[model samples]
Target: MGETIRREWRVEGMDCAACVASVTRAVERLPGVSQVEVNLMAERLTVSLAPGASVAAVEQEVAALGYQAAPLPAPDAAGSAAVPGAAGPDRSEAGGHGHAHGGHADDPAEAGKPWWRTGKAMLVWALGGLVGGAYLLSFILPQGQHWLFLAATLLALIPFGRRAIALARAGSPFSIETLMCTAALGAVVIGAAEEAAIVVLLFAVGELLENVAAGRARAGIRALAGLMPRTALRRRADGTTETVPADRLAVGDLVRIRPGDRVPCDGSIEEGRSALDESPVTGESVPVARGPGEAVLAGAINTEGVLHVRVTRAAADNTVARIIRLVEEATASRAPTHRFVEHFSAWWTPGAMLVSALVILLGPLLLGWDWQTGLYRGLAVLLIACPCALVISVPAAMASGLSAGARRGLLVKGGAALEAIGAARTIAFDKTGTLTEGRPRVTRIIAAEGAAETEVLALAAAAEAGSAHPLARAVAAAAAARGIAIPPASGAGAEAGRAVLATVAGRRVAVGSPRYGAEAARGGLGKLAAAMETLQGEGNTVSVVLADGAAIGLLAFRDEPRPDAAAGIAALAALGVRAVMLTGDNARTGAAVGGALGLEVKAGLLPDDKLREIAALRGAGPVVMVGDGINDAPALAAASVGVAMGGGTDVALEAADAAVLKDRVTGVAELMALSRATLANVRQNVAVAVGLKVAFLATTLAGLTGLWPAILADTGASVLVTLNALRLLGWTPRL
Candidate 1:
């Protein structure tokens, strides 16, 4: 193999999976082209070319298939290179086959334009007028009716004939265009010119409707790209400010965000505090308080105070950009069901054509039918045999599902992960960050007998004030929360993993583990030892406060569960998915958190142990692993679907198959629900697509339907499946 380069192009006029297949087949036939992938929803074509091949060849081949292709800038190019709906020339004006035909092409430039303004809509209208005029003339001049109808049919077949020939040359001989053209021409040959004209008009209208429905499904992703503001208020070094393009904003640039304005880039607050509504990026319903030093994502609304933010990322690398890229790129990762449907469609069209041939040749001999009747019924079967609906069913649902998930901050990598998540029977979660707050918090404070709780807490807080350990911070925070202030402390010193000693109000104070406190307390802990044991048994980290060698109090701390952890677990249970926690923490600590959330605990597991647990769970059924740490990566990859919390480390995000940007445990259940709904939608689409074809094929063979009704059934099935798949764009989890 020679050096290979991967190239991407924005392919316009692709409205369904058959278009994708057509482009793929054309490009794959190019010499030295190793791989070709087309994303129908994103309208993108990606190809891997060896040294001998060129991008020009790939683009030329796609254009020959009735679609327009333009080379995208390299991924590392400056600015937002691949933002969806980026400005480009109209596809129809770019000198290719621009008109819509049966499953052939659509004007992507007309995405947001009104129906009447699109070229496809115009074609439909013109064809409709011609057909209606011919029908009306047939009533007045019966003598010239055949000639008028023939003129209408010939005029309508112009574009379809061109596209059908192009597709046949591109290795797709049985495309919907070919079927429509063949059926209409065969009708005209059999003296069915009137029905042929009407059939051709209906086919054009069907393609126009499919284009409209496809545009609606794509609207969500386009809306995401629209969230990015076009400009930013960049602050100058001399205390002045100037407006600049948001895409030009660089790292470390300070941008001033006014109240009710969206953030232009991902950055940290530097000058002022504010409440930021991050619903646009994270789908978080509530506005969160952000102050100096807190990070803000691009596209979040600054709802309250003005803020001067120091940009931490360039415009193209912001959160919103990554999401848009994720959604567009997701189309490449096809689901198993999608692949199966494509495979079935590949053979379905050819088989239908063969059966249509057999019908045309054998019917006159076996069924005692005349040549005209046999030919008419065979053409009707050929029209019904076009696999447009079956081919489009899976991908349309997948695209709509992914777009909907992105809007809610649930970024499923692709249809594969989306499908696997729905069938998951067990969900394994990491304990530290996934289920709990992952930081120690003060939970209880018990004072020794005869000693005031305030005095004991004050002494402990003063001693811990000089220490920066997590437990010390928890102690100080607990005291501050209760309005207890720490006094002056001096000679602060610590023994690693044992104790911190200091002088508070001229009394020697020590805050340390129970063992260290017992050694310092000359009078012994007395009944405080039992309380310490109980706290430790309950998974709390107990710290003893000793004043002048006498035990004063006991402080119990633990990493508490997140606010919605229980609710998330309960929601999974409601969906028939069992939730379990897998952690490296001790059994006691794991049980403490898991018991609170009512989840099964698998504690003291190493990374390898977690992988083994995942493998074992897979035996019962598909397992989904949700985690946010490096240790969980192995298990994540081993599970059926891996979900990373968006706030997790880069390794976790890269390893997982999906991400919940809101960092809420409840998002897991929401993801599962969305997946189940999407798969259900796919099933509905496939059933409709195949059921209609079967019913129509039967009727055509029974001599009950002819060319016009057959074409109508085929076109209607395509439109129906597309509209059905579009329903997923509005899907929301019931939980």
Candidate 2:
């Protein structure tokens, strides 16, 4: 065994799933090639090669399959080096004929050309003219009509026949081109020249329609890359600004943003305030108000005021760039349904050819049919069984679904995750950042005898100022909000998970859990015990302040649920999915939060305990775990689907199968709705593709239809299937 290296190439003219299979098969046959993956939506091919294999051989093999291949630079060469439209040769350019061995050309250049200027359209027009000329000559000289029709059919078969031969030699013998050439040649041999001419013309027109639909789908995903501005206004140390390419921006560079201009990079506001419309990156419809010190994402539009922002992320690491990369990567992984369709089509194509052979040979011997009749019926069967429609049903829908989700800030990793999320039966939510705001706030305060509320808050804030715990921050924030001055504390230290002790104004002060406060207070809690009980019962975490071994005051902090938490839970219930909350918080606090949102609560759980609950929840059906902290990473990976909130830690995002970038609890329900809708669309497309094939095959074999109808059955079904799948690109949640 030798070391293996992986390489990626941008492929041209891969419009359908069958094209992907052809490219895969051709490259896989090369010696020393270990693995191959083709993503049709992104038009990318990835191959792993052993040490002895050469990149030239891989490119040659793909070229043999009638697709153009170009090597991509390493991912980290430059910030936007891997981005599609960033500072490189135009990928849309297709050299030479701009045609593939398949029946249609999906080269980006060809797809964008005017309909009358396209090669497919030109072919259709030329063939239609020939057919029309033949018919006109028939009225003037009936005896020469057959010869003229034969001439037109032969001319049409020249391109089709050449492509069929190339595809056969490249290991795809049952391609649509092969079927078309075979049917048309058989028609000419049987003296149906006029019908053959019409059939050829109709097939060309069908290919044109398929190409148009495919171009539309590709355009939808490619639009995301265009959100980034090409140029950025960079500010220098002397307070002067210069316009430069966006990709040249480095971290910490300040840039001025004008009203109605798209932000050039991900940055934080440094000088002014403005309302930014972030719909392009986050799908947020309304413009959000942002002031100095707030972060802004690249691709957001500055809708109101002038501002200067300091760049926080490089061009390629911005939100828009990441979204584009993630979408392309997602399209590379095949879902279970997509894999099944591909496998089924692989067998169906060859099997259909075998059945066609039997129909032609056996009909003459067993059914006493004439030679011409048997041959004609066999050709019809071949046309009816092209397999173009059935093979494309799954991928077309999956691509559209992924693109639609990306547009709405819902990023699924791939088709597999998208499919799994749709079938989620029970959803488990982590409490802190996933359900509540995750930031504790001071809700109430109780002062003991001889202690003013301000005095108590000031002393506690001084002791907690040195700690970074949530409760400590809450106490400090409360004191600051009240404009109370906190004197400097000396010898400040935090006890592990318990308390913080400090010397405040020459007197020792302790602030932390109620138990720690009681221990420090030599004169017990006394009158403050009842107040502590009331606060705890109300689901608040109480931190007591003590000075000179005497209790001073009690601070009650509570993390509240988000505004949409209850509505989001109700939405899941409406969809028949049960929502549960799993938290490490105490049972009383968890219940208080969960109860308000009508969710079942499993409180006081460790990391391992959450995994157990996830495993138990799986018994009923698929489980989707939503979390935003490192503690939830285990359960997120353990569930059927893991969704990370965009505001979550990096570890949680890495562990999750999908991410909700808008950081809204309502996004969870929206993601579920989108997934279910996409699955339904796939089912509809498959049913349409398969149902038409069965119906047409039966009719063709019974002698009720001929070559024209057989060609329509194949080409028409493909167009219908593609159009149906494209509907998912515009899908939205009913809620």
Top TM-score model: 2
Q: 397-487 in candidate 2: lDDT tens per residue?
A: 8888988988887888899999999999899999877787768999998999999999989998888886655677788899899999999
TM-scores of the models, in the order given: 0.85, 0.87
Could you tell me the TM-score of candidate 1?
A: 0.85
Per model, state how many residue pairs clash.
0, 0
Instruction: Give candidate 2's whole-model lDDT.
Output: 0.81
RMSD for each of the candidates:
6.5, 4.6
Q: Give the clashing residue pairs of candidate 1, or none.
A: none
The model with the greatest lDDT is 1
Cα lDDT, model 1, residue 383: 92
The parts of candidate 1 lying over 4 Å away from their true place are 75-99, 102-112, 442-533, 541-557, 647-653
Worst 10 residues of 1 by lDDT: 90-99
Clashes of 2: 0
